[model samples]
Target: MSGLRERKKERTRQALSDIAVALFLEKGFDAVSVAEVAAAAEVSKPTLFRYFPAKEDLVLHRFADHEDEPARVVAAAREAGAVPLDALRDHVLAGLERRDPVTGLNDDPRVLAFLRLLYGTPALVARMHAYQGRSEELLADALGGADPLAARLAAAQVVAVLRVLAEENVRRITAGERVEEVLPGAVAATRRAFAGLGEGLSSFC
Candidate 1:
């Protein structure tokens, strides 16, 4: 019974998000109302708020599953007795191979359209920055009980690399490059970026 309730709730949440995105894309984010989204999804406004507390969340909730991905990778690496940097690198490589949506290498038309919506909308962009800030905090915590400043610095660099890579992938795809054509360069850039992070700033003046 509990499991069935959870599945039903998941369906409701997904339906709200799907309908919200469709409407936002059809009109514009600012032009659409939360009440309209609730109406389209056949849920009460309160029910929609139960799942997404803010208007931005209607679209950004898609990223909720990945909010702590980097932190999870660091924790898993620690458990495996491996370096977190290498773990993150391998994760990016695997994601690239799979053309993961978060990696921005996915060529699906809908995904492209969604990315377009996210980048084009200032409110969504601001909200995404806030989400990344939270992600940084999670990653810093996962970096272990080190100097707090050091962990924060490392997390900042790591997250910056990821943001740059993802943005570049989106840019290339939106510019009409196929995923297959962009894959090689993406892999190479990610490897170099991670290598720089793993090596640290010892050689710098």
Candidate 2:
């Protein structure tokens, strides 16, 4: 049936990423070839390309699920008659509490290795920036399509705040702090950051 076929395809996709990441970590991102990843995953180079269009995708594809998450949060917030900023704040707090990998709070060995691969690879970093750009566009559309500049500026500020917080979480965890130890600080930081966003900074001068 269609459902079974979809599950099988998902398994193959996941296997490819798992093999690719393992190999990339073992060696290095630029040093590894798409053909080699295909060989390790027991698929042809063309088939691997069919699943992931580029070499960078072999690693960044792990983020495919959360690619449009911020946009979705914005949309859902509007539907519920709530402001996007509040929704974003709550969503981020939940991720921190759960230590979501996307939030960079997970300290699993594999996750640490994967983060190293991403941060150390220039190609992956560039590709990640492209992804973030697209995310900002989607969020801008959700916020308002009338004024592109305003929407984009708002999205950029929001995304930048969350990205820094997540990276800081990764840094502390890598330095041996447990998620529990970081959660309180993360919660306080989120509240303060969002509050600053809600209140204009003109008076600070």
Candidate 3:
């Protein structure tokens, strides 16, 4: 029964987010109101608030699934007796090959529009920083070691490198470059970025 209830809640949350994003994309983020999103989703403002406490969350929920991805990758690497940094680099390279939106290598029109909306909105950008901070914390926890501070610093660097790489990919794609054209450079950049990290973090984790 509890599982069923959770499933229903997830569906409701996804539905509301879908409705809110469509409305925001059509009318612009600042132009739309929480009240309007709630109405469009056919729920009262209170109910929408129950699911997403902030208006920004209506859009940012799209990233909720990926918040722990870096941490998970590190954990999996440890379990498999692989270097954490290498695992993360491979994971990102694979994402680029598949044009994962999180890697910002996707050129889908809808994804491009969504990226524009996310980066163009100051509030959304600020909130995204908060999300990155959380990712850093999670990765730090996963990279646990005797020197806690070192783990945290390493995590911060890793998260920042990944974010910058993704941003660059998005920039090129949005500037009208084809994903295939950007693939080699993107792959090379990722390797260089991770190689830099390996200089200090290879043995730390």
Candidate No. with top TM-score = 3
Tell me the TM-score of each prediction against the true structure: 0.93, 0.88, 0.98
Tell me which of candidates 2 and 3 scores higher on TM-score. Answer: 3
Candidate 3 all-Cα RMSD: 0.8
Highest lDDT against the true fold, candidate? 3
- How close to the true structure is residue 128 of candidate 2, measured as C-alpha lDDT? 85
Q: Model 3 over residues 1-205: C-alpha lDDT tens digits? A: 9999999999999999999999989999999999999888889999999999999988899999999999999999999999899999999999998889999998999999999898889999899889999999999999999988999999999999999999999899999999999999999999999999999886665
| Model 1 misplaced regions, further than 4 Å | 1-4, 201-205
lDDT of 1: 0.89
Cα-based lDDT at residue 136, candidate 1: 90
Off by over 4 Å in 3: none
lDDT of 2 by residue, 1-205 (tens): 9999999998988889989999999999988988899889888999999998889988888998777898899899889988778888899989887778888888788887788788778999899888888887887788775667877888787777777887787778778887788879888988998898777521210
State in Å the error of residue 98, model 2: 0.8
Sorted on lDDT, highest at the top, how do the candidates line up? 3, 1, 2
User: Quick one: RMSD of model 1?
Assistant: 2.7
RMSD of each: 2.7, 3.4, 0.8
Clashing pairs in 3: none
- For model 2, state the Cα shift of residue 66 in Å: 1.0
